[model samples]
Target: GESFDPRSSLYLYGNGDGPTSTATIDFAAATGTEYADEVENVSFRINDIDWGSGNHTDVVTVNAFDA
Candidate 1:
């Protein structure tokens, strides 16, 4: 197997027809260290209070879009 790591993480954003909704990621506020790889399983957890009052549950996954 090969090892893969991410230098930095990018903010995932989503756009809607009515308004432009955004997600705030506080990687710095994370209690522990997080790492990513181009190939492998990944996961994400939201600990920020500013996200919302409702369940902000999510499934973390990454995929390669280009060769």
Candidate 2:
């Protein structure tokens, strides 16, 4: 399921390689204000996360909309 409201808040997405480590996603909004800007791919970085004991891959989905 997607977050109910993503535009007004900061959406953090992530994925994990294994139980040893995890990855984080970073996004750059077209502009600082959510209402006056469009969303773009920006970029992402991996951060403290877990991949569930190397058994399955973790994926994070972000839901963004015009505020």
Candidate 3:
């Protein structure tokens, strides 16, 4: 989605048929330490996409707030 941050993106090289030489990342170095069972709730949205294909699926749960 448009709101998904570029910094948090996962890149895969040699998927074949790309613009040019793709970049890579070291996942092990990225995820440091063992799981601490730390759970946090965050809000995200999907936008600017053509859902006409209906090829993917996801359940969106919105948090209602009164202002």
Error of 1 at 34 (Å): 34
Which residue pairs come into collision in candidate 2?
A: 18-51, 22-49, 24-46, 24-47
Q: List the residue pairs that clash in candidate 3.
A: none
Residues 1-67, candidate 3, lDDT per residue (tens digit)?
A: 3366667653333322323333432223225767543434444444432223333322233444432
Off by over 4 Å in 2: 1-54
Q: What TM-score number comes out for model 2?
A: 0.23
Error of 2 at 52 (Å): 8.0
RMSD per candidate (Å) reads: 12.6, 11.2, 11.5
Local distance difference test, each candidate: 0.40, 0.46, 0.38
Ranking by lDDT: 2, 1, 3
Q: What are the clashing pairs of model 1?
A: none
Error of 1 at 12 (Å): 2.8
Model 1 misplacement above 4 A:
1-8, 13-53
Residues 1-67, candidate 2: write the lDDT tens digits.
Answer: 3334345444344454434433353444566665543445444443444355555555555454553
Tens digits of lDDT, candidate 1, 1-67: 4443456444554443322344453223234546432333445433333343344443343343421
C-alpha TM-score for every candidate: 0.19, 0.23, 0.23
